[model samples]
Target: MLLCFVDESDQGDFHGFAGLMADEHATKAITDSLNRTMRQVAVDWGIPATTELHGHPIFHNKEDWKHVPTRVRVGVFHKVFEAIVAEDVVILLRWVHVTRLAERQARNFYPVNFPPEQVCFQHILQRAQQVSATRDTYTLIIADDRHDRDRHRERFATYQTEGTPGVYMQTNLDRLLDTVHFAPSHMSRMLQAADMLAFIYRRVHTVTESDPRASREMAKLWNTLVDSGRVHNEGNWP
Candidate 1:
């Protein structure tokens, strides 16, 4: 049985990337740290980091994605994910479309077109069910902007009762496995890691840019940091 959690981030959406892009260096630094942390985790577990795991796609502009090589561009996703999760570990990935959610009155206050990546909640829900059907797995998904009271109220009122879109995923997974629990995303380290991983994944897998490259460079840098004993534990980072 694997106790896993999943979250998503979309670089293509304004709400998702606007603030991050406001300070390019800050965005790069945090993402760099993410890459670093994941690699260290792999190293601590005695796994070798490879280019196969390093190269990620990063789209500076969402509009450009339609022009990128879909096949090759999508390949980076496989590479990044292959490195993040071990073969024996069953990963539960949650998806939600932030743009669509924002269109609704309750969530409209949030930035739109932030990242189309977060919008794939229904897809992630289906994938989770499929994975759980064959293996013992558990995952909690967090939608961006879900931290607000209205979102929670909707979850309890509509989702919990009538079985709404991202809300009813638990029931769908229950048909396949015994355990399914949904919680706010900000609450879990595993989900936070998943979000960071997903963000790095977008940077490395979507477009060719220096920022994505920074993710790999940061991974190498962190390797040196760990070797130097600068970071003694996990809770020290953003």
Candidate 2:
């Protein structure tokens, strides 16, 4: 079976001690690219294109999507996702968060809250572990790491040194799974979609950083959906 896994990171604008600073331009660009890919997928699947075709933004919540589940909302990957899940694949949408912290403490993870980046990654790894325990399939990770691959690698390395298990440390998952790396270029459909989403957020925050009123509103929206765990959902066990 082939599973098309999708993940999002830093949608709320909290980047390594950085506050709710969303890059709207990057987000918009990536959102558009994702929509284009979704459109193609929809057409290929013979699905009717409604006015809401690829209409949702890359970063959205239940408030934005009605047909899909909380975790897999309607967005760039929706078309192919809808088609594939019915047959040979299971679509897993893992949303990653990044935020501020006093230091790297693993114990403070369980009952995690918003504004903590490392904890979110830990939770993801934990979920992955649970998935592996029950399922016989492999996990494939398709990521957009053009901007901070090296930094992420270094961080992962440190985590390994500290005996912390993360997605990168999934040798068991790797045995059943393969990691597909896509460059954030105009060539790859997935990368293009990711770029559109990233660019949209980048532009929005860049131009409106100083306006506390608007920033506060965006932050509230982000925290309400993503940070509050309202949009985070898991699949049933086998």
Candidate 3:
């Protein structure tokens, strides 16, 4: 089975989801290596090993990361990325533009509050199913426990038969397990990694950093992920 961990992020003009999927047997190794990387950062940076690692805090230097230098915090993310790359996990992403979503809403294509999170989640689920089908395996989605996640779980139930809404093609999503599960990011190293990736992906694509060097560094990390040959699919859509 493919165990896919997912998280969402929003930037100035885009919202998206990012995920890391690995064989069921391999997830343990990936999380273990990720824990090791976090612990090493804790040792070197003088923070608790149990401190949660996510993009905002580390990038913006908030909370436990605030005392650490910006360059050092970036190094922490680099270490985390190295651990992920070593695990050979496949990456997945789906992005939605705010303008496109607004236009759709204006045409009554989607409700005013219809979330881009749900839109991106549906696409990533479709991608996971494709991967699972080719490998002759089943998939399970584990997402960060955002307040709106119950809606996604309920939405996918119908998607299993009726197919995802507002898409050109029908994707019954049967290759995935019957439900979408939500977990607290603080408790899962894999989820933290997904959270960080989503934030970085959205940030690089949507934000124009005031500092050129800042933008370049974020783009570098994203390029590294793409160049690693593990990004099975990346979609930007209405």
Candidate number with greatest lDDT: 3
Question: Which residue ranges in model 3 land beyond 4 Å of their true spot?
Answer: 108-114
lDDT of 2 at 115: 32
Whichever of 2 and 3 has more TM-score, that candidate is 3
Model 3 scores a TM of 0.92
lDDT of each: 0.37, 0.36, 0.83
Tell me the spans in candidate 1 whose CA falls farther than 4 Å from its real position: 14-84, 92-119, 136-146, 149-171, 175-188, 211-238
- Give per-residue lDDT, candidate 3, residue 132: 84
TM-score of every model versus the real structure: 0.39, 0.38, 0.92
Query: Candidate 1, residues 94-162: lDDT per residue as tens digits?
Result: 333344555662454544343343234434444544454544544333333444435443333443344
Kindly list the per-residue Cα lDDT of model 3 for residues 124-206, writing each as its tens digit: 98899888887898989998997876777789898997887765546898889969999999999889989888988888777
How much does candidate 2 score in TM-score? 0.38
Q: State the lDDT of candidate 2 residue by residue for 41-84, as single tens digits.
A: 45654433321322134334322234444333333333322222
**RMSD in angstroms between candidate 3 and the native structure over all alpha carbons:** 2.0
Best first by lDDT, ranked: 3, 1, 2
